[model samples]
Target: MRHGWEGAVLKLFRGKDFTFTVTGAEQVTERYRRVHFTDGGLLQTLGVHPTMWVRLWFDNAGKPHQRAYTLVDPDVEAGTFSLEFALHDGCASDWSRKAEPGDTIEATVQGTGFDVPDPLPPRMLVVGDPASLPAINSLLAVAPKLPATIWFETTHDSDDELPFRIEDHHDLRTVPRPKMVEQVKADLQELVTADTFVWIACDTTTTRELTSYVLKDLAVPKDRVKSLGYWKAA
Candidate 1:
């Protein structure tokens, strides 16, 4: 039998050290940067397959931070992929801002098993903060032509740059940062129906809260709501 998309192993390229050169950077928002890597050999060695999740490890100054980010656009033919970073004054963000081309950084390869829904429901809910945007966007790209309700809670208005195609039945609602849970709760209460399937990603705290709301308050079936905790506050 052929291996399904879930079991593919992308190449795992080891850099000279835990440092990366900044080939290019684009300001998606005051708190986010779109960084591109140019080490073709490293990517090729890793055998990066489409839709695989890549985890980058680096130390800022002396502190270590491990961040999991997906490859935004993986061009196997060109040997390039984009990783979007949520800029924090923290170590990882500090290093990313200072990286330039020819710099080296250590990265690990991993695969994703989260299955996308089939025969999409009439309306669906996608909820998360900036960190979860990439996964949410990827999910949306392949979603069926049914209605979608997207609720994004961002730290700043500038951090609201989503580069995915939105169909006619898709609705995007943005609420300011620090209030992700509150805003998402409100949206779910008003918009969710018995048949709606909900996908949520965010910090640990918000994930727990949203999961409880969906499974307890709204009485949504366990299988209909999916929630993930991308990170925890320091």
Candidate 2:
């Protein structure tokens, strides 16, 4: 007999793990790539949300360096998920760079991030570093077609910078890396209106600074602005 309510309870208590075999890898740019997984039918059977953050484990130096990545373009009907990685000089990046098709890795489902807010505001502002682009793009995909501004900062000036398409209702701006936080702040101070909702994702320092400016300096309510620290400088 298929375990029903008890299985749900057991899943919550015992936690289920997902193992995926890399089916394909495509380099989209010098600093970005897409990896496709072809395992984890059980996780799909358990009904995992598309936006849920998953912990990935790769065999590197006999220690699993865990990193959080958003599930991109999950096809429940097809039993697969796509994870986009931003190549950097780190443990996860090293594994991703060397990983090939048919390689098996482990992952676990965890972490929920910002969902679109209700009673939607008239305008929206999204600001983040290149690492946070996937989350921003996912938000934009589901967001109602409205006037939105996205500010992205990256070290390289390349045509293939970000992977996703911005709707016509969205405006995108790019700046160099070192001054991204300041530029975003200045943009918000000038462009933000009473009906604007601001979403920010960046390093810890940037998140703290921008959160304070939006809440204390601009008097935007905490509810109207959401900020998250996607990573921190070492």
Candidate 3:
């Protein structure tokens, strides 16, 4: 399948391409699924890092569509990893729902990297929804000992069953999409310190609003906070 212009742009930027074969799948919940894949040598070629993600190309009615997914449980030696999908109405979710053993998908790797803070922060403030849950889990995995306060927005009742790698040191709060931003703002001053690391991955609007508030209103240094809009609201 032709990747369209997006593939061309990525190629110009030196994006590495790979084809992943689906090994198996799991139904985590009514609204979520996990698809396991042989890495197609991606791990050996690119290495790995926390929150590592790759763009997957899917056929959308003969048109190319791509979505970024974070790698879950990546095993370097085995050249394997799993990607969790928060099932929704879209081409990416559709492909994930029907993916079976031996099914292959094209993937591109570019602009995916993370560097842990030199001196670990005393605390962490994180915000995300199901769409970014895998990345949230990855971030927390790297700092298992760090105390973290996480706000997860829920759109469906089944979202409660979404796999979250929260530890004893983590405080998790579930909020409706409408209340998430306000709740975070109300608690920000107390939770965010000068050295507190804040990571947010949500709908584009929410991510942008929270990032602006944290950086401008609270005067947090840009380097201390990581923000990414995982998806756009419909």
Please tell me which predicted candidate would have the highest TM-score against the true structure: 3
Q: How many residue pairs clash in each candidate?
A: 12, 0, 0
Query: Where does the lowest 10-residue lDDT sum fall in candidate 2?
Result: 1-10
lDDT of 2 by residue, 1-234 (tens): 233443345468665567888888888888887888875784455654424566676545654456778777777778887788888788888877877988888765544545566667777788877777777877776655877888887777553456856878888888676888788888888887777788888888888888899899899877888787878877
On lDDT, who's better, 1 or 2?
A: 2
lDDT of 3 at 151: 92
| TM-score per candidate | 0.77, 0.85, 0.99
Those runs of model 1 whose alpha carbons end farther than 4 Å from true positions after fitting are 1-22, 38-51, 60-64, 160-165
User: Candidate 3: how large is its RMSD?
Assistant: 0.7
Candidate 3 C-alpha lDDT tens digits along 68-159? 99999999999999999999899999998999999999999998999897578887788999999999999998879998899999989999
Instruction: Give the Cα-based TM-score of candidate 3 against the true structure.
Output: 0.99
Give the range where candidate 3 is weakest over 10 consecutive residues by summed lDDT.
189-198
lDDT of 3: 0.93
- Cα RMSD, each candidate: 6.7, 5.4, 0.7
